[model samples]
Target: PFVPLRRITPTELATHGARKNASKIYWTVLEGRVYDITPYLPYHPGGEKELLRVAGKDGTKLFNLTHSWVNWDNMLRGCEVGILVSGNEMPG
Candidate 1:
């Protein structure tokens, strides 16, 4: 059974997760939702460009459907980290 992954935000990464490799999880936005695609960073077909688009800001619209549909597997590869909320970052 796969666990549903949690949501995260740029602020969280800026605060702590960006300092290290294992801890450096990045994300992108598709439609109106934010999807954590950090695991796909190394495997991104578009290279670092995709990661840079939303590296330090909200990626609410830069997410490409083609990427999501093509690399959906990478998105589900990791366990749920947590959901980012206003003020709080960890999911409950």
Candidate 2:
């Protein structure tokens, strides 16, 4: 089941990313969607450092470059936090 998620503004996303390595909760944006990748860090096949490199920032480009064929929606289904809503967009 694909449950709808809340939309978050870029400002909010920036705030979360500003925490850097200190944050207990790490959020990364991919294809306009926000995901809590903290738990997946240790389990990441490439190792946590690779994932941590994009922590609190958009990882869409990196993800696509490295694993475009991967089914991210299914892989990250449980980690999804919200959608990255722009200033001009209305959050539902």
Candidate 3:
């Protein structure tokens, strides 16, 4: 399922993916389907050119891998950071 970007927040990142004293990172979705997205970070078409934008963060790698069937390829364009907004829709 696709989640809106608005629902994600820095605190969420800190709690979920952002780690302490780490420059490289990415997120993992523990549910809804086992998937890991860490490998795709360096390959992010967005270019690792600007590490500042994603420094000490988890790229929510699970989102891409878990939802591959969703054709989320295009969604990667708008992301300024890696975030995982997994699980079913948030109770509408």
Candidate 4:
């Protein structure tokens, strides 16, 4: 089955990112796309704490600075949670 991808707002993305380690699902935004990285935390080569630092926020800068060589698209394939809705418009 091909389920449609979800479109989330920045506010919603922030809320999910704020969950951090306290929530079952830890989310991160990169290049306007949200990904549930909870499962990859333990396996991250840099270690879980490294990823935790940017758990609930945009990690694009950090990610590029630290491991720009990494194939993020392939790495986050199935982990994608949703796409950030365009512009700053918040859902009502």
**Candidate No. with top TM-score:** 4
**Residue 55, candidate 1: alpha-carbon lDDT:** 54
Q: What residue runs in model 3 are displaced by over 4 Å at the alpha carbon?
A: 1-24, 28-35, 49-70, 73-92
Name the runs in model 1 displaced over 4 angstroms. Answer: 1-10, 16-38, 65-74, 77-79, 88-92
Q: For model 1, how does the per-residue alpha-carbon lDDT over 26-88 read when each residue is reduced to its tens digit?
A: 544443344556666777678866566665344544554435455443554452345444545
- Arrange candidates by lDDT, descending: 4, 2, 1, 3
What is the RMSD, in Å, between candidate 1 and the native fold over all Cα? 5.1
The TM-score between candidate 4 and the true structure equals 0.81
lDDT of 2 by residue, 1-92 (tens): 99678888877766666354455777889888898888888889988878876777898999888878988788888989998887677655
The estimated TM-scores of all candidates read: 0.46, 0.79, 0.27, 0.81
Best candidate according to lDDT: 4
RMSD of every prediction? 5.1, 2.7, 10.9, 2.5
lDDT of each: 0.51, 0.80, 0.41, 0.81
Q: What is candidate 3's lDDT per residue for 1-92, written digit by digit as tens?
A: 99543444344444434345253444333222112244556775655443223433442453345444554434343333433454344633
Which structure is stronger by TM-score: 3 or 4?
A: 4
* Weakest 10 consecutive residues of candidate 3 by summed lDDT: 27-36
What lDDT, from 0 to 1, does candidate 3 have?
0.41
Count of steric clashes across candidates, in order: 0, 0, 2, 1
What local lDDT does model 2 show for residue 42?
Answer: 83
- List the lowest-lDDT window of 10 residues for candidate 2: 14-23
**Model 4: clashing residue pairs?**
17-56
